[model samples]
Target: MAWNEPGGNNNDPWKNRGGRDQGPPDLDEVFKNILNKFGKFGGGKGGSSDGKGFGLGISLVVGLLVIVWFISGFYTIREAERGVVLRFGEFSHFVEPGLRWKPTFIDSVLPVDVQTVRSLPSSGSMLTEDENVVRVEMEVQYRILEPYKYSFSVTSPETSLSQAFDSAIRYVVGHSKMDDVLTSGREVARQNVREELQAILEPYDMGISIVDMNFKDARPPEEVKAAFDDAIAAQEDEQRFINEAEAYSREIEPRARGQVNRMAEEAQAYKEQSILKAQGEIARFEELLPQYQAAPKVTRSRIYLETLESVYANTSKILVDTKGSGNMLYLPLDKILERQNTSNAPSTNRRTLEGLRNQDPAAENGPQDTGIRSDRLRSGRN
Candidate 1:
């Protein structure tokens, strides 16, 4: 019967002897007997309990090994790590950063760095769609997003990513023009390559997310590098010239517009002034119209004299065709006026006043006689 079965081995070996009840072996006696057996086995081949002592030593050794195995199972994961656990060489679960324990010799943990960014470089001279070759260098930054996939999904995630990088870049370069690969279209090419790379990598799902992709440098091949450099320099110069021209336009356009506005204002002011002057002249003529109607001959003579006076004031010479003269007379009126002006000098005027007071009244018409003589001489010249 089993030991715990009722009415069976109570049969308890400690209490039963030869099917009769004997008090349990005394504790003191049992211990003493074990010690004596140990002492005899250690001293010499003098006891029959040697095999039992050997068995006890084996049990103690097995227990110590078991305790060591349990203790070694305890492990600590660093803050920047993720633990990928595998049970019996197959994926099980992931563990976070902290102290953790697992069944000894039954599971394994692979720590992967998830927080750090990794860089991969790609560079080569590749052909473009326009049958041109360009040397390109690029850098790709990535981080692990799924540790399980990083460790178990692929044999080599980095290598796969590198291949994908090459494929994406070559595809983009092959479809783009050489100018795009090497010059102003660089940013556009970079964006296209990144998008293509992401598309290519999507199916693989290697548990890596691209942090950034930089187009480090792009240049022409060695055989034509100098020529390409010249072309690039020319393009830069063209852009610079265009920018300077635009700046000049921006600066000059406002001044031109302002000049137009100023000219327009001046013309408007001139128009208003001319209009007002014409209106004033018309009003003055209207006031004279009734007088001319009442006395045509006197009004006509007065108007002619006033017109002559206005014309003479602005002129230095006059022309006169005498009533029956066959030729024109040119009068040097400016010279006569100059002589008359000199006669008003301080000393000359004072002398003339004294002379006039002592002289006869017949000489009072001296200036008039001289003016008439001047007129006669002007007519004789004609």
Candidate 2:
């Protein structure tokens, strides 16, 4: 019965065996009892109740330990990272990003960031094909491609890459002249070096892909800095002169072509005009051939008169051959036209006044129709 039960006092754990109402069990007695129960688990003669409670405690502790060990194996990988799993210090499979689990102390995960681009620079004074020294600086940009290969292919991939760059650059520079290294040959040298580097690295399978390789600097030695500067300036000046010549050629060539085309067009028009004029003349001659055969002298005279008319139609000067006079009279018809126009009004008024006077008895008798007579004289003179 329990201690609070109506008739059972032996169920009280704090009650003394002396049947006294003790405050609590003695410390020595509690310790002894626990030791006796643990001893009974190995076949000691302890109380059955003590052994059962101790057995349940051991089972609960072991279960809690198992749960802790399983949860401890979980790990997380980031978005850009690639994880390589190793089982017992040997290569296993790969794992992706996010929370993952591996057996503790058995499988290990190595996370390598494959997305980040890394750069390595190699620069030094190297000998050229011409036995000239030139300083060159270059950078290689790369990223990890295969995590397992990168981890296990070579002892140290970055160091190997640096050595490879040095070797390739030296090889290319050795085959190139100093001027090329410093100027137009820089691009060729860069290409050659990259090609050579790739060739050297392919057998090793370093698992690094070279994104780009750049020749950052290619220059002469500092000892000859002034000379190199002058050389570079002259090269620039030569390029500038060539560019200017090209620009001038581009600007002036079209104008010359246009002028040539214009001259050709004008010549073509002149040629067509001459051909048409010749055709018309041929037609005219063919028609006039029959006329000449019908009346020789009359056709000849008619042709002469037609020629005179064509010539005189274009002339503004009038030449008058006076009768029996050795000297010919010359008059500018344009000037005569202007003078006649100016004096016409005054001449008409004078003529009218003269007629009035003649009608009156004060003027001497004159021929009738004097205006008509004057007009006839003017026409005869013309």
Candidate 3:
């Protein structure tokens, strides 16, 4: 039956025992009743048991809250990261990679990647040392080295690094020539910028190390880009020409040296040959001197005959009989020369030809067959 039925007891679902107009049961009273049940174990009286129960309940709640806060502070650091711990908003220490815990409300942890290289780019139109404006772009790569300084040395390490990069790049570019920034000096400029950036950041101890700096792009303003391009091309061409000339010199120098060495060798050989030939001739003359001094006339005649033989050895010979009828008779020495083939044939032929040239007409007084005999025979016939 509904509690409000006329025959049944009227029970007010929303009323307490005082029955005035309570909206719901009082939470404090409900809690006290529940704790009193626990307090029964202590065997306390009415008010003392209730008070003891409330105190135990409050202690349990505080202990549970403390445990939850401690557990919440536990964190994990990755392999590539470092945890920068702070005690009451002040730098404390660095935590390595692993599961770690800290006082939840007292200590805070900031995880930073120390192994990863971060890059920042700086680019702008800057004036060079040569009073020329060039658009330059550069990249700065860095890694967190000291997490404490990176977190506390400055409000923002990345922002500070970026500003430092700008400063360094501008300083380097301002001191360098436009041609160098855009040409063969790019590497030098990149190294200088990296050094300058490191120097600038060292004073602040931003806890970041400059890994490298790259010269990304360097060019003149668009208004003058064409002219700069032409100049760069001309410079490249000049370098190419120089390299080619050097290569040519390298190639041709060896060949020229070889020729010079060969000529020197040939000259030395010729000099040796001439010296030996002169010595041989001097020895021969010395040997002949004693023979000439022993028998003067015979030696002289022998020398003359040898000289004649030597002279005739190389010439063709023909015997001419000029004493016959005022006409000359010629002997065919060429045919005889063709028939003779001996090692000493030239010397024999030379001696024989010389003897024949010197011979007198056969028995000059015995046979006087001249033109007068021809006249006597003609008169007899008449």
Candidate 4:
């Protein structure tokens, strides 16, 4: 039975002693009771004292937390770095070097090394314009210009930049010749790669500024390395040969021209000498012709005698006069000549004959007697 039922518990002392208050407390009454206790404990002097102490403790904790948070947000940037501030996941502004701060949890900051030159190396085997494969190694230097773009515009700026660099290198390599890639074309390749990378980054809004691109090494593959080396050697040899030829030409050309000039001068001198000699001979003949016409017989005889004298000037002779004694005088001239023979026989004989001719009044008869004596001597007559 229920507790209020009286049939079984009429004699129960607990039930009969007090009149029944209620089955359960009403919601309003319970609420009012709690409110009254709360008001009584909260409104009194003791209660007010406890409430103020608790509020003070809470404020102290909150202040400490705020100080700690502020200290955490107060970061200093170095001279080489730039700070990027993001509020509520949006770019706010860039902070310069030195002390900087942002609200905790409400704003975020990223420090980028803007002034630092970053280097990235890229390498790959690429096909050139000549359809030859070559390995190209290069280095790219860059720096951040816009901190906001660097932090938010791309998910990973370095990775994206590297990808763009690879694409640019490939594009440039594809358009270049293998010989150029291995030789003087490296500078061109670097410029083209830098330009292409800049173009790609511009569209992606990347904040990277390309400082320069340098080609470290570029060469043909190992399979063709020997052939390329041989080709280079051959080219060097060819250049050496060309230089040698040029030098030879440079040294010999002037000498040849000088020789030609000397020969021409000699020929000209010969022509002048021949003309002067011919004119002298003609003048001499013209001068002699007038004398010859004035005294023909005497001039002719003189000319004949001069001609004979000139002809016999270098010869040895023996003379005898058979008409005066009517006897041939055997002079034994060959024996006398043998006895007088010396290194200066011709000069001695010329002097002796000249002295005799100067002393004799009929010197012209000497040669006539010489011829007759020679004829008698040949006939062995005395």
RMSD of each: 15.5, 15.0, 10.7, 14.2
Each candidate's lDDT (Cα)? 0.79, 0.79, 0.79, 0.77
For every model shown, what is its TM-score relative to the native structure?
Answer: 0.56, 0.65, 0.62, 0.51
lDDT (tens digit, per residue) of candidate 2 on 261-299: 999999999999999999999999999999999987668
Q: Candidate 4: worst 10 consecutive residues by lDDT?
A: 42-51
* Candidate 2, residue 358: lDDT: 52
Once superposed on the true structure, which residue ranges of model 2 sit more than 4 Å away at CA?
1-55, 288-313, 317-382
By TM-score, how accurate is candidate 1? 0.56
Model 1: lDDT equals 0.79
Candidate 4 residue-wise lDDT, 169-264, digit = tens? 999999989987886567878888888888888899887788888889988999889999888788779889999999999999999999999999
Ranking by TM-score: 2, 3, 1, 4
lDDT of candidate 1 over 1-382, digit per residue (tens): 6766887446565556777778666899887577556656545255544556656655766899999999999998899899999999999999999999988889999999999999999999899999998889998999999999888777898888999999989999999999878989889888988899899889887888989989999998789999889999999999999999999999999999999999999999999999999999999899899999998766765565455445545556553545465676565756655687554544443443345325434333433343564566477565
Error of 1 at 90 (Å): 2.6
* Cα lDDT of model 3 by residue, 1-382, tens digit: 7877888676768765575766676899987777776576545565455666667766777899998998898899999999998899988888999999898889999998889999898899899999999889888878888877888899888788888888888899999998899999999999998888888988998888878777888888889889889999999999999999999999999999999999999999999999999999999889889987897666665565566566666677665554437455667776777787756666776567456435633212222332453454354334
Which 10-residue window in model 1 sums to the lowest lDDT? 360-369
- lDDT (0-100) at residue 141 of candidate 3? 79
